[model samples]
Target: MDFVSELAVARYEKIGEIVGKCVEKIEKPRTFSDVIDTVVTDKYVGIPIFLSLMWAVFQFGYSISVPFSDAIDVFFAWCAGIASRIENPYLASFLSDGFFGGWGFVLVFLPPIAFVFIALTILEQTGYLPRAAFVVDRAMTRVGLQGKSFIPMLLGFGCNVPAIMATRTIDDEADRKITIMVNPLMSCSARLPVYVLFAGAFFKESAGAVITLMYVLGIILAAVMATLFRKFIFGGSPSPLLMELPPYEVPTIKSALMSSWLRIQIFLKKAATILFIGAVIMWFLATHPWDATNGGELIENSYASMIGHAVEPIISPLGLDWTAGVALVGGFLAKEIVIGTLAMIYGVGEEGVADVITQHFTPASALALMTITLIYVPCLATLGVVRQELGSWKWTGLVLAYELILAYIVALIVYAVASVVML
Candidate 1:
C-alpha cells in the first residue's frame, strides 16, 4: 500500500473506533488468519517472505518430482524398445522414433509440471497469491505497473497463454498492453524442462538455484521492460491498485491435487496434439533418405542437420552449436519441444539426456542457452493470443522483434561474463 492507501485505511479505522464508543460491542480475539496476514504482509518481511516462498516452491517441485519423471522415462523407453524390434525397418523407425519418441520425450517432464501447479495451487487456495500481489504492489507501481499487472505476471509462471488472457482484469488499456508484452518474459512452466535439462546437466547440485535464478531473472526483466514501455509507449502513470484481500483458507489435499491436475490438462492436450505433430516432423527431418543416410545412421546428411547448420552461424557467437540452434527452432513452436528435439536427436529421452547434453555445452554456454530460452520469441500459442488480444499484428511483430533482439543481447552478455568468471 502507498501513503494514500495507508491514510485512507487509518481514517476508516478511526471512524470505526468512534462508532464503537457509542455502541456496545463484543471484542473477539484475533483469528489465525489475522496472525498469518500480519506476518505475511508485514512491511519489512513481506517481500523477503514472498521471495523465500518462491524459491522453496521451485526447489520443492524439482526435488520431489525426479522419481516420478524417471519412472515415466523408463516406461517410455521400454515401449520404444518394443517398437524398435519390429521386422520391417521403416515401420519400426516410424513407430519407435516418430510417435513414441516424440510424445514420450515431452511426457517425461509432466510430473514436474504437475508438481509446480500443485505448489501454486497451495499458495492460491490459501489466498497467499493475493497477499503476494499486495506485498509487491508498491514496488509494482514504482515500476509504472500496478498490483493487477502482477497477477497476470504471476500466472505467466504457469503459462503465457492464460497469463495474457488474465490481463483482461486490468481495466486500463495501456496497462494491459504493457502487461501483455512483458508477460511472455515471465518464464512459463513450458520453459521448466529446458531449465531442468540444462541445470541438471551443468549445474547438478545447484540445479535448484539455477532454476530459481531463471524465475527471478524473468520477473526482473519483466519489470524493467514494463517500465520502458510505460515511459515511451504508454506515457501514463499506472492506475492505483484497488482490490479486496480474501480471507485465507487451508487447501484440502484432494482439492489441491485435483485443481493442479486440471491446470496441467492443457499441457497434456498440447503434448497429444501439437507436440506430437512436432515430434513426428522433427523425426522425419532427422531420419529421412533411408539408404543415403542409412536410416538415421548418418544424421549429418539428414535434412535436420541442414536446418541446424543454417541457423548455427546466428547462434554460434553465444557458444552454441547447430543442434542447439535446431532445438531453439523447435522452441519457437513450443518451449517443451526444445527438450523433445534434443531427445530425438540424441535418441535418448530425459533418462539419458543429461549425459548427451553435457557434451554440447560448457557451464558458460549452458547459462547463455538458458538465458536466451528465457527471453526469446514467445511460443506460437502465446503470439496468437497477443495478436488477438491486442488486435494488432503490427504490435505482435514488434514483440517478436524486440524480444529476439533483447534475448540475443542478454545471452551474449551472460556468455561473455560467465566465460571470464570461469577463467
Candidate 2:
C-alpha cells in the first residue's frame, strides 16, 4: 500500500482500539438501537426502507389532514357568504372574493404542511434523519457529491432558501455549488398544495402514490443532473463518507413541537407577508381596466389576461391556456401561489378550485404542469439566497436559465408520454 494509505489504515485501527477500550455494555446486551440499525442502515434494505417510510408519510399526512383542510374551507365559505350579503358591491367583492378568497386558498394547505413538518421533526429528533443521509450517501457519492452534501439536500425538502444557505457546511466549493444548484429538485412543502389540488381533482384514488412518484422523480432528476454537472461542468472526486451516527432515541414531545413550530412559523410568516402582497397584486391585475360593459368578468378584461395571453403560445404545447399561463407567471414568485392564482382566475375561491381546474385542464395537461412545477426554478426568495451563497449573479443567472430550459423539456416529455398512453 502507498505510504498515505497505510497511515490512514493505521489511524482507523488506533481509533477503533481506543473506542473498544472506553465503551462497555451495561444491562441490555445489545441495545434497541443496535437491532433497529441492523435493518435500517443495512446497505441493501436501508434505501427501500427509506422509500417505504416516505410513502407512508405522504399517505398518512394527506389522509389525516383532509378533514382539517375541509374545516378551513368551510370557514372560508362562511366568510364569503357573509361578505356576499354586504350592501356595497365593490367593498364586498374586495373583501370576500379578493382578500379572503385569495389568501385563504394558501392557508387551507396549513394542515398537510404542518403534518409533514411534524413527521420530519420527529424523524430528525429521533436521529433517523442522519441515518437516512448515511443510507443515501453511497448513491450521492456515485453522482460526485460528498456524503456531507446529503444534509443540505435533505433540508431542501422543507425549503430551498435555507437549503442553499446550508451548503456553507460543505467544505468543497464544487460540491457545495452542485448541491445548491440541484437542491430545488427536493420538492418543498409549498409545492404540496398544488400537487394535492390537482391530484385530488384528477387522480383521486391514487393521490398519495402520484405525489410520491413526483418526489421520487425529483430525486432521480437531481441525481441525473448532478452526474451531468460533474461530468461536464465540474470534474472532481467525491470525498469519502465519514461521520458518526447518533443512537436512536424516543424524541421528546417538546423538542419535536419546537422543531415543527419553527418550520410552520416560516410558512405562516410568508403567507401573511409575501403571499398576501402577491395575491393583492394579482387581484388588482385581474380586476382593472375599469369599464361598465364587462365589469363582472374579472380575468377576461383585466391586465393579467393580457400577460397570460402573451405567454400562452409559449406554453400551449403542454395544453396550458392563458389562465394556466398566468398562474405559472405568479408561481415564479412562490409555488404556493400557483393554486391560489388559479383559484382567483377561475373566481371559484378555495372550495371550488379543484372543480374549476378540471374544467380547464386535461389529465395530460395537468400532469405536465405538475411536472413543470416540480422542476421549475425555485421561488424568487430562493434566487436571492442562491446569489448570496454563490457570491455571483453569473452563477445565479446560469441556475435560472438552466432550470427554465430543463423544466420546459421535462414537462414536454411528460406531456408526450402521457398523451401516448392515454390515447
Candidate 3:
C-alpha cells in the first residue's frame, strides 16, 4: 500500500481502538444511537468555542502590535527628517521618501501580522484546527470541496502562496487545482493593512467589525465560486474528507511564540525586499524627471503612470480611478504593494498613507475598492505555484480570467448598490 493508504489505515485502527475502549468502560451497552450522539450532538460545542477563540486571537494580536507599530512609525519619521537635513537633494529624497518611507509602512505592520500568526500557530499546534475543519466540513461539502481543503484555505488566510503549496496534500488533481485557484480569495494577512487602514481612518467606530466582515465575505465568495467551478468546469464527485483529528494538547508558549516570530520574520523580509523595491520604483516614477516640483503630478508622466493608464479602463467599472488601478496591478505582484503604491501616489510618506486614505476615499469608494481587492487576480507568487502544481499554464490562465471577470462584476454590483443606499 502507498503511504497515504497506510496512514489512513493506521488512523482507522486508532479511532476504532479508542471507540472500543469507551464502549467497554460504560456500565450499559452503547448503541449506534449513542455513538451518533457522542460524535454529532457533542460536537456543537466546538463551533462556538472555536469562534470565540478566534476573536480572542484577533484581540490579542491587535493589542500586542499597536504600540510596536507606533514606535516604528515614529522612528522612521525621525530618520526621514535626518535625511531631509542632508545636503544632496537626490540622496535625501531617496533616503527619506523613496527607501525609508516606502519600507517603513511595511515594517510597522509586522507586529500585528506576527500576533495573528502566533495565535494561528497555537491553534494549529494544539490540534484544534483539524476539529474546526471537521466542524466546517459539511458546509464545505455543500460548496463542492472536501473538508481537508479547509486546512489549505486556512493557510491562505496567512498567505495564498503557501496555501496553494499546501494543496499538495489533496490527492485528486482536479480538486487540488480548484483549491489552488480559489485559495487567493481567502484574504491573506498581507491584505489586512488595506482593510485596516481604510476602515480605521474612515469608519473608526465600525472599522474592526467591517474588517472582520470583509474577511468573512472573502470566505463566502470563495465557497460560492468554488461550487460554481466544480459544477460547471471540473465536474467530479466529492471525495471523502478523511482527516485525522489529533488528540488535543496544551500548546507550548515557547513554540507558539517561535512560530509566530518566524512568520513575522518571513513577512518582514518579503516586505523589505519585494514590497520595498516596488515602493522605491513607484517613488522613482512619482519623483523622477529630475526636476518635477514636489506635489506635482509626476505619476502622470512616469512609467507607473503609463502602466496605470493602460489598465484603468478595464478596472474603471469597479469604481477605481487610475491611481487605484495602479495599486491593483501592483497587488498582483504582492498584495502589500497595493498600499505601498498608494502611499507613493499620494505622497503621504511611508506608513502615513492610512491616515491619508481616510481623508481622500469616500465611504462608498472605500467599500468598492475593498470589494474589488478582495476578489481580484491572484498574486504572482500564487499564480506561479498554481501553474507548477497543476502542470499547465492553461489552467492558470483560466483561473486568472475567471477571477478578473468575477471581481469586476461583483465590484460593479457592490459599488452601485452601496452608492444608491448611501445616497
Candidate 4:
C-alpha cells in the first residue's frame, strides 16, 4: 500500500472502532491510480508486461543509437589513420594500433550504452522499477529472496561494484550473503559492447531479442542460485517483502537525461584511469618482442597469443580459438576490454571486427560466447568490492569457482542446443 493509503486506513480503523457501529463502513470511490494499478500489477499480465517493456527498452536503445555509433566509428578510424603516420615505428604502433585502434573499438559502444542508461533512468524516474519489484516479489519468495532484494539487483544492471555495495541494507547476514553471491549474475552495462558485437554479427535482426535474453538469463540464474543457497547453506525461508511503492508520475526529460549522464559518467572516469592502464599492458603483451615479431607485425608470436593458444584446448569445444581466450582473459580487468582485445588480436577496426567475427564464429558459439560473458566472473573492480564486503578471500574464491563452473556448463548446453536448432 502507498503511504497515503496506509494513513487513511489507520485513521478510519481507529475511528470505526471508537464509533462502534454508529457509522456505517464506507466503500470509497477509486482514484486514477487505483485503475492503473489493476492492470499494471495484474497476476497474469504483470510479469509479461515487465518482460515486454525490457525488450522495448533495448529496442529503443540499440536501434535508435545506430547512427551515433556509426559516426563515432568513422571518427575513430580517421584518428587511427592520422596516428599511423608518426615518424617512429614503435611510437606509431602505440599511437595508431594500440591507442586509437583499441580505444575506438570500445568507444564505439558509448552511444548505445548512453541510450540504455537513459531508458533505465526514465523507468526509475517514473517509479516503475518498484512496481516491477512488486510483480516479481511472489516469485522471489518462492526462491528464498525478499522482493526488496530486487532493488540492489536492479541497480546491478548499471554496475556490480556498487550493486554489491548496495547489499549493505539487508539486515540479515544470511540474506545479505545470498544477495551478494548472486548479484553478479546481473549483466552490468560494461558487457553491452560484447553483446552488441556478437548479437549483430550473429543474431542480426533479432539482436535486441538476444540481448534481452541475456538480461533475463541473469535474473533467472540469480533466483535459481538463491534457491540452492537457501536450501543447502542458509536453511531459512525468505523474509516477506515490506516495501512501499511510490506513486507513479511523469518524468521530465531534463531529469531523466541528467540522471542517465551521471550513471554513464562512471565508465568515462574508469576509462581514463583503470582502463587506460589496462589497455597499455594489453598492448604490450599483444605487440612485443619488436625484434622477433618484426615490430608487432606477427601477433601470433606475441606473448598474449602464446598464452591464448595454451588455453585453446579448454575453449575449443565452444568454437572459440586462441584469440577469444586472449579477449576473455582481458575481460577480467574490465569487460569493455573484451571488444578491444578482439579487435587488436584480429588486426581489425571497429567496423571490421564484426566481419572478422562472423568468419570466425557461428551462431551457436556466438550465443555461447554471449552466455558465458553474462555468467562468468565479475570484473576486477566488482571482485575487489565483493572481497571486501564478504570480509574474506574464502567467500570470494567460492563465488569465483561457482561462477566459472556454472558459466562453462551453461555455455556447453547452449552451444549444443543452438547448434542442433540452427542446423
Write down the lDDT of every candidate, Cα atoms only. Answer: 0.89, 0.87, 0.78, 0.88
State which candidate, 1 or 2, has the greater lDDT: 1
Ranking by lDDT: 1, 4, 2, 3
Cα error, residue 411 of model 3, in Å, equals 1.8
TM-scores for all candidates: the values are 0.93, 0.92, 0.86, 0.94
> Cα RMSD (Å) between model 1 and the true structure?
4.2
Candidate 2 Cα errors over 4 Å, as ranges? 1-29, 296-298
List candidate 3 stretches off by more than 4 Å. Answer: 1-49, 292-299
> Over the stretch 1-423, how does candidate 3's per-residue lDDT look in tens digits?
999999999999999999987876547786654453355325667566666777776666666777887888888888887987879888887888787787677777777788789888998887678777877888888898888799899998898878888999998877887788789899888887777667767677777677777877888888998999899988986688887656667788998888878777778788868888877776777676756444334557666677789988887765677888878888887777787788777876655787777665777778888887888887777788878887898888887898888888877887888788878
lDDT of 3: 0.78
User: Clashing residue pairs, candidate 2?
Assistant: none
How good is model 1 by TM-score? 0.93
Residue-wise C-alpha lDDT for candidate 4, range 1-423, written one tens digit per residue: 999999999999999788986877789888775776788799999999998988988888889989998999999899988988998999988988788876786678889889999999998888888889999999988988887688889889889988999998888888889999999999998888899989988888999999999999999999999999999999988777888878778999999999998988997887777776777778888888777778788999999899899978988898888988998888889888888888888877777899999987899999888888998999999999999999989999989999999998999989999999999
CA displacement after TM-score superposition, residue 166 of candidate 2 (Å):
0.9
